[model samples]
Target: MSGGFKDAKKDGSDPAGTSMSNGHMGIREISAGVAGGKWSAYEITEMYIDKIKSMDDRIGAFLTICEESARAQAKAVDEKIRSGKQPGKLAGVPVAVKDNICTDGIRTTCASRMLENFVPPYNAAVIEKLINEDAVIVGKTNMDEFAMGSSTENSAFRITKNPRDVTRVPGGSSGGSAAAVAAGMVPVSLGSDTGGSIRQPDAFCGIVGLKPTYGLVSRYGLIAFGSSLDQIGPMSKTVEDCALMLEAIQGRDDRDSTSYRGEYQQDYAGRLSGDIKGLKIAVLKEYFTDGLENEIASSLNESIRRLEGLETSVDEVSLPAAGDGLSAYYIISSAEASSNLARYDSIRYGYRPKEYADVDELMEKSRSEAFGTEVKRRIMLGTYALSSGYYDAYYKRAQKYRKLLRSQLAGVFEKYDLILGPTSPVLPFKIGERSGDPLQMYLADIYTIIVNLAGLPAISVPCGFSRDGLPIGLQLIGPHYGEQVLLQAAYALEQDLKLGL
Candidate 1:
C-alpha cells in the first residue's frame, strides 16, 4: 500500500470482506468502516487477534494478549453503532500498549521481573483516554527491563526482534511497541520515551513515532523511569495514525501535576493541510558528525532535498550543547530512576523473597534477585551521582548542562520552524552486537536524547531504506506544543516519499 492508506477505497466499500485483516489499512479506514456499518467491529478485532496469535510467537512483541477483553470492547462498539449512537474518534480500532502503561486488571509488567505479576488497580491517564475514545486494547507489548537498555535484549522475558530483520534488534526500550505496529499486529501502540526510547525504536522498525511535549499527555499511571524525562506517545504505521492517536490521548488532567494546563489545538489529524511552504527547518550540524552511518546520512540528505523541493527553506545550524546531551540525560534520568524505583522493596506490592533475615535483608534480596543487570547498574550510577560529595560534580552539573541545551534549542526555534536530522546515528544492528558494551549502546541514542532533554515535541518518520532493506528514519522536531505544524510538515514529507511497509 502507498502512504496514508491510499489503497483503501474512500467510499467505505469493503473489498472482498477482508480489508479489515489486510494489515495495511490505516486507523481512519478501520474506524469508519465499523461505524458506518460496512463492517462489524467484531470482525476487525477478530482479524487483528488472529494475526497476533499467528505472528507473535515469532516476533515476541506482546507480553500479554487480552483476547477476552478485546472482544468485549469490540462488541460494545458494535452495539453502540447499532443503537443509532455516535461512536468516539477511535471507535473500534485495536491498540497495543507498552507494558509500562498501566491498564486496570491487565497486568502491567514493564518487562521487569520485579513487577512481573503486578496488576495495577487503576489505568494510566492515556489508557483511560483511549478507552473513552472507544479504542480496544489488544495486549501489552514487551520492553527492556524497567526501560533501562537500548536493545530489548535486557528484558527479563524475551528479546523483541525487528520486524524488518529478525536478526536485528527493533531498538528499545519501546522495541516491542514499534514491532507490533511494523508487523501490522495493530495499527498503533503507546510507548514511553525517557531518552529516545520511542523514536529510536520507531526509526529501527520503519514506522512513525511521536514524543509529545512534556505534560501534553498525563503521566498519572505510567511506571516512572525518569519521571521528568518520560513521556507517553503513539507509534503507528503512518503519520496520520500517529496524529489521530495523539489527539485522542492528549488533554489536561487534574490528577497529574505536570500535565500541561495551557490550551492548544484539539484536532491534530484534522489540521494536516500539507501546506508547509516557507517553513524554515534547521539541520543540526553536530548530528552529522563521525559516528553516523553512511546510508542513514545519505537518506537524511535526500529527505532534506525533498523538503527543499516542497518550498521549505533548509539550512545547517550548530548547537554545541547538543553534543553533551547524552551525558546530562543519563545522569538526570538515572537519578530520577533511582528515586522512583525505591518503592519496590519486598514490603510493597511487587515481587518479594520468601526468605529473609530481617526487613533490611528482605528489601536487599528482593531488589537483588528481581532487578536486572541494567536496572541495577543505573540505580548504582544514580545513587553515586546523588551521593553527598559527588552530587555537585555530576548530577548538578548535568542539570546545568540541560538548561543550557534547552536554551540553545529555544534560540534555534526563534529562527526556524522545525529542526531536522537523522533519528538514529546507526542502522538497526544485530541483537547481541552492542549489548555487551554499555557505552556503545548508550551512544546509539546520541541523535535522539536531546529532544527528550529539552522536553520538546519530535517525530520519527520513515524516509528510505538501506541496501540490505533495513528502514532508515528522519526526525522532525517542533517547538514545545507545536505538534500541529510538526505533524503537517511530517505528513507532507511522508506523502512525498510514499514509502510503504
Candidate 2:
C-alpha cells in the first residue's frame, strides 16, 4: 500500500484511491514510523509532498504549495533524529494550514483578492506551535473569502471539490483544509470555525474537525473576520489525530489579549480512555426538527443508538433561543466584520486602484474592485446594522438574543456532559446549489452557529454516510474549556466505528 505516495499511473497523475492502509495515512502512524527509524523525516515529508503535487489538481484544496520551504524543514528534522536527539511529539508530520492564518514570508490571501499579495512579517500563533512540534509546513489551503461563506465556492481563487465526490461541494470557509486531509494530501490541517466552517467541512469531507473554545487558541496573526467568534482548530482524518493537533496549538499568547492562561496543562491525547459508559449526552430537539434531510436524520438516529449501546445516558434537551441563532449570528458577525474590514480602504495596505480622480474615488474603486460580491453584501449589512438609526433596532437586539442563546446553552451543559447532534443539517450539495441565495447558504450553518455564539468547544466526526456515499457527521459540543470530555466521548465513538482511517 502506498500510504502517502503513488507509483504514477498511465496519465502520470496519481488517482485518489492510492493510499497506505484504509486509503489514508494518519499523523500518529507517520510520526511513529519516522521516530523509530523505519522512515526518515525527509522521506515521510517527501512522500506527502509528491502525493500533493500529483493529486491536488482534481481537488484544488491548496492555494499555495510550499515545496522548497517544506523540504528544508524536513531536512532539519531528519538531522535531529540522525544526531540521536529528542524530537517533538509531531516530528516530521506534514500538516496544511488554512490560508487565513498568517505564515511569516508566505502570502496569506484569505481567498480574497484584497490581500492576494500581502505576506505577514510574522507567523500566526498556531503556525509557531506547528513549527515548534517539528511538523512540516506543507502549504496554505484555500478558504471562503475572509471566511465569510459556508461553501468554498465563495472563494475568489477557486472552488475546492469534495474528496469523496468531486462533483459535490465541500463545506466551507475551511473546505480546503478538510478536503486536503480527506484526500490523503496531508494527514492533518488547521482550520478556523466561526459558524461551522471547520466542523461542517469535516462532515462534508468525511473527517474529524475540532473548534476549540474561544480564546483557547490565540488569534493574533489570524486575519479578523468576526473577532469575537473566530477560533482556529484542527481538521484530520481521525479523532486521535484531532486530539494530538489540538494539544500542540492550545495555550495563551502574550500578543493576543483574549488568550487564556490556564492552570498547568492536561494530556489532551494521553487522557483518551475511550470509555464513555456513564457519560451524560443530550440530543438537541431543535436540531432534529424541520429542514433536516431524512437521510441525515436516519443516520443521526443510528449514531444515538450506537452511543446508547455503549451505556451512555442519552436524553432530549431544548434550547428554544437556538432557533434564533442563525439570525443573531449573521447580525453580530456582520456587524463585527464591518468594523474589522475598515482597515482595507487602500490607504496603508491591501489592494489599490490603478487610477482614481480623488481620495474618495480611490477608496471606492479599490474596494469595489478588490472585494467579492458576498463580502460586499456582508459589509453593507454590517454597516447598516451599526449605523446610527438602526444600531439599537438591529445590532443591539441581536446581541440580546445572542446572550439569551448562550445562557440557554450554558444551562443545558450544566445538566449534561455533552450535546450531540448532526454536524450539518444536510449532506454536501452541488457546488452552485445555494450560491445565488444567501439565505439558503446561511442555513447550511444552522446547526453550528450557536456553539460559536456560546464560546464553547465542538467537534464533527464521521458517523455514517448518506445513500449517495457522501459522509454524515455527528457533532459533540462541550462547555467552555470542556474539550477533554468532548474528545473522550468522540474517541469512544470513533474507535467503535473505525471511520476514515
Candidate 3:
C-alpha cells in the first residue's frame, strides 16, 4: 500500500528498485520529456519495468511482462526523436493493458486456464492505436477470468491487491490495470467495463477511469464479455491523462461493426479547462439508497457542494427502473458471455481434455476443468435463461427492463447534462470477504451497472477517502456520446475537490 510513486524517497530512489524521479512523472511529462530530448524513451521504459519487477510481487497486477518488446519500442522512439522525426502524441509513455485485450505476438490470457497460452496474432484496435501513438506497452495485467467477476479474486492466476490497502481487493475484471496505475507501475493502463469493472476498481484504487459510450472506442480485438455492454477504457492517475488516453484510442474502426460512425472530438485533452459553469447535473436518488456507506454518501454530498460552487446546478432526480438494472444486466451479459465463450471449446483452440472417451465428454471435461466457478455459474444461468420455453420469461424480460432503464436515463439527460453518484456503495473490501457470497459481490456493482446497460459514457474520479483511509470514487454519467462535456465536468470537479492522491 505504501510503495507507489508518491512514496518515493527524498534521495530520488524508489523502494521498488527504480528511479523515483521519472516514476513520479505523469503521462504528458514522460511523453514530452522523451520527445524534447530531455530523456530517452528507453530510460522511462526501463524505470517502469524495474518498478514492476520489484513491486508487482505484492500487488500481482501483471500477468505477462513484455520487457523485450517494450524495450525495443522505446529504443525505436528514441531513434525517431534523434532523427528529428515527429513521434506520436503519447511518445514514450508506458501503458499496461488488460489481459483480455489482444497484443500481437504477446499472450492474451483472460486470467483463465482456457487459452492460457493463447498468443494473439494481431493487436486489438486500441492496442494498435496506442502503439501508433508511440505508447510503450509494458505488459498485460491480470483480470477476473473471462471478465466475469466483480473482484480480482476470480482470476485463475493471482489476486490483485489494492494499491491503497494491500489486504483489500483492487476491484474487478480490470483490477490488475487499476492496481498497476494505483501502484505506479505504469502511468496509464487499459481496462474493459462490462458492468462496473473499470469504474469500481478505479474508485477502490483512488485514481481516474473513464468508460466511453458504447462503440465510441473500437472493440474489434477485445475478447467479448457482454457484446452490448463491453467497452475498453482508460485508467490513469489524473483526469487529464485519462482524457489524453481516450483521445488517442477513440475513433472509428472499419473492422468493428459496432464502432461509432459519427465524428468525435479530436482534442479531448485540450478541452479540459475545468470550467463547469452553467452545467446541469442530476443526482440519481436510487444510487444514494440504503446500501451506500455513510462516508461515501457524505463525500458525494461534499462533491455536489463543490460543483455548485463552480456555478453548476445540482438536483435530485429519480430513475426508478435503475433498481432493476442489476437483474437485467446479469441476464443479458451472461447470455452474451455464454455465446461468446462458446468458441473456446476444446475442439477449436482452447483447453483440451487428455482422456475423454468421446467428443461430448471431451468438451464437457475441458470446460468443466478450465473454467472458474463464477464463470460456470453464469454460463449455467444464461443457458437456462436462453433455453427453450424460458427466453421470454428471463431474456426477453431483461431486454424490456434494459429498454425502460435507458429510456428513463434519456429523459433525465434531456433535462440535465450529466448524472452524478457514488461509483461504489462501499470502500474496497478485504480480499475474500465477499467471495463466499455471490449476491453480495454482485451488489458491489449496483451503482455502476446501469451506466453500462444504458450504453452511456461515465467516469469515476477520486473524490475522498473513508474513515479507514480507503479511497472513494465519484461517478459522472454523461449522455450517449457526451464524453466531451463529461470529461470537462469531471475535470472541473477533480480540480476543485483536489483529493491530492
Best model per lDDT: 3
For residues 59-166, could you state the per-residue lDDT of candidate 3 as single tens digits?
Answer: 999999999999999999998888999999999999999999999999999999997988889999999899899999999999999998878999999989998899
- On residues 302-327, what C-alpha lDDT tens digit does candidate 2 reach at each position? 88888998899999988788777888
Q: Model 2 — which ten-residue stretch has the worst lDDT?
A: 3-12
Name the candidate, 2 or 3, with the larger lDDT value: 3
Ranking of all candidate structures by their lDDT, best first: 3, 1, 2
> On lDDT, who's better, 1 or 3?
3
lDDT for each candidate structure:
0.89, 0.88, 0.90
TM-score of every candidate: 0.96, 0.96, 0.96
Per-model clash counts, in order, read: 0, 1, 0
